[model samples]
Target: MQPPSKPAPPEQQATEAGSVTTPVRGALASLSLAMLLPALGTSIANVGLPDMAKALHAPFQDVQWIVLAYLLAITALIVSVGRLGDMLGRRRLLLAGIALFAVASALCALAPTLWLLVAARALQGLAASVMMALTMAFVGSTVPKARTGSAMGLLGTMSAVGTTLGPALGGLLIAHFGWPAIFLVNVPLAAVALLLAWRYLPADRGGAHAKRPVFDHRGTVLLALTLGAYALAMTLGRGHFGARNVALLLAACVGAILFVRVELKAPGPLIRLAMLRAPVLGAGLATSMLVSTVMMSTLVVGPFYLARGLGLGTAVTGMVLAAGPLVAAFCGVPSGWLVDRYGAQRMGGAGLCGAAAACLALSLLPASLGIPGYVAPIMLLTASYALFQAANNTAVMGDIVPDQRGVISGMLNLSRNLGLVTGASVMGAVFAAGTSDITGAQPAAMIRGMHASFAVASALILAALAIFVLGRALSKP
Candidate 1:
């Protein structure tokens, strides 16, 4: 026989292994739209709050619920819906979610009263929870294991793009069409996502003889209640903590204890405690939360420093704020490539090191250097964040058993959400304390607040780095 033909090139081999299959590309498109719509929903409405309040004849506080209702529903119900998807079927549930989201978006656009709009937003949030939680879970089945990092990176990029596009797009839509246009835009996007998902996502694999998993109703209710209470405690009253906040926080703690007690005894628990005991999964979630907290500091603190301290105009401040997500969107895919080449653990550590360095630079750099100094560090921080997110998600999802993927993905999203909520309150408070009165603070005071806030952020990054290192060491055989 003739000598064996030379092996295929890496790209061809990857294609043969199904990474670039038509069905895989279709599935990825479906997942990308799913990720994008939720992120767009989250940020797009903020720019239209004034218009909404004027149209609905409501105060700013009442109009704010149009946003808060959506956020609260997603934060509370994400894990419960994910578990339900595992018991039912992810594909079927995702299709239902997309359909529901489309309907809710239409309702939001047509609502005549502020309360009605808020109710529609709540419903939309429920749908978004399914899309967000299940999209990452579906990644395991859609793409080859070798390309997990790439897929994760792509999803991250889409998320960043949605966030970056929302304010600008919403402004244009509202200026020309009205506030409702922002919600109405989601309808067509959801239809496209639904069609792709229906056509290409792998069908749920189980026969009539298959023993379906039981749903843990008690655990689900308790978890939802606990999370709702905690979210309310963190978000209500803006940044000022009060007696009501304390009471709500205490109730959440009690609810959490009850939830754990119920889960431990349930025959079919919503989440198995043993899974969290795994060092890699636990560390990944913890670091995700920490990194998210640090990242949110940039949002909460950056605007004040840029506008008040640096004396930038409104348009300039907005442009400067957009740069972080822009850099993150561009870096996400390359970061995934690095993860695939260098391994998740190594890439994760390197990302954390870079993040810590960037945070330190932000803390120490003088305000005299102005926009360039601030922008440079923020870009570095965001790029590093993209690398860490890709590596962490790939590592966590790489080996999960198929049945548990939905809940695990939900937990990952939940951790990041909670961190964002916490950072908004905690970091805002830290900056407020440093400045004494932020509204009338001098430039020097604003600089002080910025320094203090970033110093704390740098500490948070170091803590995440420690957790990552410790987790890897313990995960070793």
Candidate 2:
């Protein structure tokens, strides 16, 4: 007779069963905070811009750099920082990033000059890029593979919470403690995150004897410059593309060509071109960008539609606009749970179908049905987006090897950010083209613009769905 084996250790059992143990919980809390801080940093300052401009004696155009600097820094450097984490150590880099973020937040809070504050914000963005990139990278190492979607969902929830909380929290803080309070809030949160990460997160593997790949400094610089140019081209003119925008865009195109050439010839490339040729990764990135573009259209066009088309007051419009993100925030965890239950590829397809249907409904139904109609479709769109995000993130990150997680995670984030930038430009243009003098347009013109915008959005969602299906087909042997 064979003897019965002893039960696995509590930690091992919990992992095997895909349950969150104490250690896993702590790690998740740290990662969630990491994700949240960057998101908060992105949105919180928007509410304080007026105060900041007044205090610093800067014009609105110059003050806008306070936001732009941070965004540009993140967009330009995210992939490089992710690669750095992969080369050095994610835990080490992430801890350093958290510490740096706290210091930069203090610098922003204390800066006396506008440009100084902008510089500090840029520094803060650099740290945020590391945090954002590495937090997702750390997921595969921290949780059981079966629970990757759940972890991703939790991180998504934190991101939505931070984004949603930022405007409201910043308003209250500014009213009570001034604009600096917005930046100062991050200090304590970062400190707590630092402690949690130091104590609970897993240490990096390998030792001094393990061989490490060479850092691609040339590729990094070229890619950063390329991305910076592209971001500037997309963002500089605020909705109206001008001569400088065209010049920057052209420069970006040239820089991209040079970057690809440099990367291909390098002995140890920053990004393996072959990896992009793989149907799954390439299609994942493309679909992510497409989906993000559609999502951003709602933000770009929703306010105008509510205020002009429906004749809602500013307060009511704001509240109605808030509903989309709130739905997304609440749906995040459940969406992840569904991804885990049904599998990422399947859930991803389901989410895309739902999104397409919602977009079509928004395009056709909202004018006749009014606020309830608009709100319902927006809610469905956001919920579908949350599901798609969770599923897509899981599908992409779940199969990545540990060595490449950081860079791959960075690529995923980069794709989404690029989509946002493009959406703000292209979708805004489409909306504007659909209406004459958008600010003073009549209800009919506003409705027409809204319909045109959502119709385009629906098409984008359908394209993403096609890409998803094609990718799955091609990935099969």
Candidate 3:
């Protein structure tokens, strides 16, 4: 047997011809903080929605737009901005994004009307897209190739932390101050991140090193339309199903077809469909999406089961639910170590198995078993997501050349967002279909719905596992 290789040190390298050396330590902290803000921002407002609605005197339908607008903007614009980062410069774009996020956050905090707040949130989402797209690009560029998994692990850790904190923190802020406090919280985080990023991050040397690529204006627009329509359809499918949802879904399908055609012919495609044929890249992305779908399903369904099925209060349910993301956060660094040592495929497969097991456990366990039973499966599901994300991200980014990191990162983020929305749509439909009448749903009916949702989620994860296996088989030497 071969002796274990020594781990690689965190070393700096020049990301461009004339760029300053990538600061491994500082860059990790800076990038993690930058990534954390948007992740937190995405969910922080969820707990504040009711508070905001009350304060603004807005109906539930209008308040829904606050979250929807942000999500839509990010989904629509991230890939284009990521490609822009590849063209213009990651550092330049990141700084601009941070500044914009801060400013928009302020606007959200001060907005007197629901419509104005929604608009501010949209702007914040645009800036967030830039930050989210470039996060891996910057990290991948900063760290040595050998330690990419470790760095990605740290990024995953921050993401888990942000997700865990968002709701709890938002609730606290809303109770103490107001809904505006939720938005105001971003100001300090973004400011600190911006300062650190400005001081330690390198300039746009990657763009300088590579030949100037033509911007694909047409491709960007079509892709944006596709994502926008798709997101809207998914969001609407949760409840507001009718002509609007059908029309938006149809529009999404048409936009997707148009995007494919445009990209195939465009000199500078937003996403290279050919490049996506690579087994590692394509399979990694698919696995990422599936993993997120499973995770999101648990997230959306678990709370309902806890509160409605088990008769737990919101506070207790929230605490019980918080266990998953908290475990995920703790799992990140160790999972990164595993990825760096063992390669992504093994870890990714293991993670998927864990997810499948968690889904099965959740499906089988009765709500009568209470929080104890839920805790174990939730931890497994959350940790599995973090594990899969860390390894899959390393694999995908590793497969790409440095020059295209921004777009790939954007694509990865896009997949995750899509998975989240898709999971919500699919699982929500399943649960709703099972319940038939939510307002008059009995505990038994709700429990049945939860079980059905989890069963479907497990089946989906198994399918993803099969796909991963096939991808490996096809990629073999």
Candidate 4:
């Protein structure tokens, strides 16, 4: 299962003409599949949540916790696991993650109670964090740096496909088989991914190197506390805004300060705070969070408006919802090529501006509009995100050294998960507040709520764009 001879480093591979050999192609394929699973799992669960609620007879808040728990685990553990992968072996950690994810999916499928399902999902999410943290590093380490954007584009395409197809697929399965079908479907696919990874991905030569940095236990603990408490406060503070939520938020603030202090003093930091001092990396990470927040807010609200408010069937809703990511998926490869040909700054800025415009358009849509009204705006929004993701990721990774790719990958993923949690919590609360006084039958109220959510998302995206522009301006010589 080892490479016949040690392959040249990625930077060296980039210089050789036509270096995408069979082994390289194999590695990309393996990484793409690994990336697809988590994205699909997340989207499928979003589509299937109502069915699970009905099957388990759980309250709305309880069922929402299933997604929240999964997100929290990933946000808390991603950086630590990523550092471990870099120190140990990325291939080794990725395989273990794939296996554990498969088992956890089975656990989720078989869980008899809602709490058990949440627990299994949390386990599944932890495994997903590992994959998320290392998959980009795998690509960077295996593929040539010259073609990094193209490789990332392909990976991005796979993720967009997962997001694009997941709702439709989940709706079909749930309608015919049940909510559990969503979980069961992952088992065989994960088994296949595990096999491919075992055969194709490169072994970590760095693992044999002595003088590896020590694992930062204190920094890891502090980061976990910071992310965990923040996620908890964001998730629970909506309706249950009590002393507990306040305390948790305060704890998160303290934990963040402590984490910074510990990382500065630690011999081996979980995340190199100094790396974030680089404008490209920091701005890229922040932009990712903002884009994800906007997208997730729309995702959380759009389906509800379509299904419950408009009385559309799940199948129809899924089809309508798929349009955005489908466009994004189709554009992914080109977006990457564009980043390589031009530059990340240009592409990233253009994407953000497009996204802002789309968000504004969505906010202006009225209650009387049909599914057709949303198609163009959704497509524009998701396509913009795809463009931004491909370019921004390339920029961030390109700036970092080879050895730090794993941690950077984890940080990128951490930003996305945190954004999702924040968006879902804040946007859901906004929608709920907007519509709370009206009866469920009042579709207009729901539409108003949806518009409010979009408006808030638009404002956030604009703020993000402002920050990005300001940072770029300041960084100029």
Candidate 5:
């Protein structure tokens, strides 16, 4: 099939070479800050979990919901909102989303009860979804294609720093002030991003002349319901669904079918699913999900091992875990160079292989290895995570037509978050289900369980790599 015919939108085309404008860079810088804010809260909150339960007098379930609610909202809204940006205006959506996110963050910080906190978290998620989707679309629209790889790399690094630093900052804040410090941290940053964006980012052109713009409401509803059901099934199917789990799983399958149906039929489709028939695009997304699952598994299972099983202090655990992403922040910009040289395909394969090896090391970690021994494996895992992320994102966006980037971004980004949630649930199931002969005094049981979990993680990553290989081999660039 001939590639989608898209002469650059006249509004965006540079008719003639022009002098440099500092404001565009200023706009990107502001966007990078706004994009990083959501991550800060997410990573930091992991460390603040105990404090949250204590302050809110909340049960374990309430705390889980707080995180889940935020993720769920993001998962549902991101793709649809990205499509909204494509139709309405990327800059408009981005600035408005930032404003909404700021308010939600404030409400979260001020929340008096667990339910109130959950509600605020959901609001935060929706707002974040909009911010993330539009900012990415805006980046693509604003930058020349030749420079897109590098632009995306810097943006990825910013996000990595936010993600990596979140916990360390949270740990420090909780130690010094209290739990609310986490949400409060976004205030100044958000204000700065808001002000800079208002002053710098160029106005969008998509809806400038349309009196009655078409909205893809059917596609949006189908996508939301699909993801919502899948989230529910995953949440409940972890032994909670019993005999009905299969039915719930089938329901999720049905939702996927319906989502595709709605997308194909909508006047303004939520996602151009047919476009993603490209094997390269498919590979990129599959690898993205795998890498996401692997990284998120660490966030989920690593804490338990540090705080309880091995008896390390929570603060120390957060710091130790932060090592990988901290290193990744430095590595992110360099990854763009690698992607340019080796292609995202090779880089993704290498990343998965490295992660698999890291998992193997963790699986085989001997009791005699001690602290220094385990650090290498952990760092390798996170670094490979860093490697694949910048690369995989490039590959996906690389193959897509410019106009469809937001939809691709939304779909791939959702896949990554879905992987994040699934990782926790999957590893949790693995940890909870398996019996260990080694407990109290005998450490073998704990080691065995951790090893099995790592091995399972490795298998998942490998599966993703395999899909990438097959899909990429089958598709044209």
Candidate 6:
């Protein structure tokens, strides 16, 4: 089912003046839709975790691990897969990822047990990693450099919309159809995206079939170790702050050292460490981690607060909880535009400031007040998330040269997920600690903790900014 990508009448290909046809537009739409599929599944799962556990008869931590495992695989493999895509063929890899994801998703929907579901989800993550790490590259392939910004801006908002819609959609599916419905939703989206990707997306035509592939095994291993160890510490450190936690942290440090060494020595490293020396890329990646914590924390606490604390139904909670990302949807495009026009440093700073202010507002909410009381803060949080994320993405991707773009994108994506995992652990602990003492009124206390956690998260954002500033200072001419 190859697409009819005729050389567009030599004159059209030669001159940029020839407007794209409806067919080409459909093709691009198909690619854009494909770009968004993995996110839909991930977002749905985040809000539907409780329902998933009930259906699978799993414990809370185990259910959490299901999500973690997917992320682990994605984070660990994205960098390697991404660069490989650049060297080989991004569209080919993307289609492969789409097919793999569809099958894994089917497995998840029909899983007979929890373990199977976990394994399926890990495969899904791997597929998602490929899609996310290379979709932007795909955009570059489809559109000229002049049109890339608008394409990127639209894609950014599309992600925000997907994320915002996912929770509500998942909740609605779970309410009547049960947890499997959430996974099942992917069947149609993936099927269509796969079709378009197969038919429309162009082939990669890089420096292929030339130099021997210098696979960076050392860099790969060290990165896996670093992220894995850090995730382990976050997942386990709570309730037992002892030798185990220390060892995990030490392991992370060791892996960081090893990874730096590998990047320094490899002929063609997995992630070019020299790129990290760029202010925009480094700052963007650092901020990605910080903003991700906000998502992790919000996902865990928001559902719980709406369902258990306020006694609102999960369905209602899903609707209410979609606000943050919905706001993100509204702001994401403009933020990308801002990143293009202004320096990433300035834009990133502005977003951080907004986020900090939002957190302060969240902290100020009293238990006596209701959801409306929190609405303003939530809106701010949403706007800030959209702005920061768009800024970071543009900055990070903009910093790198074309050849290494995929791997760099993967690394940046990994940073965002790493932030999410970190946020989940830290915020979960904070909320848990805050609720430990109370018996009947634990709900109120939990809200209090979540609010406070937002405060702490805001502080972390500032810390990230400080790092960005320091990096800038170090790079002074």
Number of clashing pairs per prediction, in order: 0, 0, 0, 0, 1, 0
Prediction 5 global C-alpha lDDT: 0.74
Worst 10 residues of 4 by lDDT: 9-18
**Candidates by TM-score, descending order:** 2, 1, 3, 4, 5, 6
- Candidate 3 residue-wise lDDT, 1-477, digit = tens: 999988533333343332324466777888999889988998898888888888999998889999999999999999899999988888999999999999999999999899999999999999999999999988766776767787889899998889889988998998899888999999999999999889877666653554688999999988898899989988884745789988999999999998899899999788889988888778878877877777777777877788888889978987888788889889998998889889888998888999999999988887767789889988888888788888889878886776799999999999999999888888888877777776678888888888888899889999889888888887788
Segments of candidate 1 deviating more than 4 angstroms? 1-18
**After superposing candidate 3, which stretches have Cα over 4 Å from the reference?**
1-22, 206-211, 237-240
Task: Give lDDT tens digits, candidate 5, residues 123-211.
Answer: 99998888777666665555555445555677778888898787668879888988888888887888899899888776765544647
Task: Please estimate how well model 1 matches the true structure, expressed as its whole-model Cα lDDT.
Answer: 0.92
2 versus 4: better TM-score goes to: 2
Worst ten in a row by lDDT for model 2: 8-17
52: Cα error in model 5, Å:
4.4
Q: After superposition, how far is residue 311 of candidate 6 from its true place, in Å?
A: 7.3
Which of candidates 2 and 6 reaches a greater TM-score? Answer: 2
Candidate 3 structure, TM-score to reference: 0.93
Alpha-carbon lDDT, every model: 0.92, 0.92, 0.86, 0.84, 0.74, 0.74
lDDT of 4 at 1: 100
At residue 214, candidate 2 shows an lDDT of: 86
Winner by lDDT between candidate 3 and candidate 2? 2
* lDDT measured at residue 202 in model 3 versus the true structure, 0 to 100: 66
**Error of model 5, residue 218, in angstroms:** 2.2
- Residue pairs with backbone atoms closer than 3 Å in model 2 (clashes): none
